[model samples]
Target: MMLSLALVCDHALIDQAGKLSVLGIFERIWVERFPAVHPRLHLVLRLKGRRTEIGDHPVTIVLHDPSGREILRGDGMVQIGEPPAGVTEVEAAAILVFDVPLETAGAYHFNVTVDSELLASLPVTVSQMPAPHPTPEGN
Candidate 1:
């Protein structure tokens, strides 16, 4: 299996026909303060499977913080359907939702593993948005 696309977004969906729709894709998070909880995040992934690998495979996704600490984990299964008449590979789409809790501003990563093998790692940077300064009335 090979990873074709992996990204962090606001929303994503996979249609019955294997079509993927993604919106509000972003790699950085801006917060007002530390120890913040990002209400919602979406992780979208697309993978291609060879014809010989037509079966159910175990998939795992893990979220890690800047200090390499595991924050959250999600597990699921992916079924590699039989390829079309003359197709040599099959495609699979997965959408995972997360309630990301950030303790400090730094780099975070979402790691994807298929069949116990790491396939993709998506990085997300969390930073504090500077507070606005008040302007003088006369100026």
Candidate 2:
């Protein structure tokens, strides 16, 4: 029930037009466990940035299996807004949700991209079911 995120900032580059500047990249990975009856896997993604219109940009999520094979991919637009003052970090924010089959358990990789450019990659492990308890009678 915990979502772990890894934020990486590449070398900053000044835009030629001076309109915007590239600061850093952020990535997160987490495992979600649902009730046994739940039919799918839900992945929630949240991005936070400053002076960036997350809604105006395109965000994509690519899912890969253990062997680095792509299994599923999805894209969507985010709703961007300004963050409170004094927040030198990313001000805008975006959230993405991906649903997949729960039966699919293994090492999965996620690649996040913007404008066809690779931003970040994340790997996660999913477990199928909890181990059963043994009875004293050995039945």
* TM-scores, each model vs. reference: 0.94, 0.50
**Tens-digit lDDT track for model 2 on 1-139?**
1123332233233245423333434232233453212223344344555554434667688878667777778887655555567654442333343454333556667787765666667766665555567878957
Which ranges in model 2 have alpha carbons more than 4 Å from their true place?
1-40, 50-55, 79-90, 102-105, 128-134
Worst ten-residue run, lDDT, model 2?
1-10
lDDT of model 2 at position 7: 29
Error of 2 at 50 (Å): 4.4
Q: Hey, what RMSD does candidate 1 come out at?
A: 1.3
Any idea what lDDT model 1 has?
0.92
lDDT of 2: 0.51
Give me the displacement of residue 91 in model 2, in angstroms.
Answer: 3.1
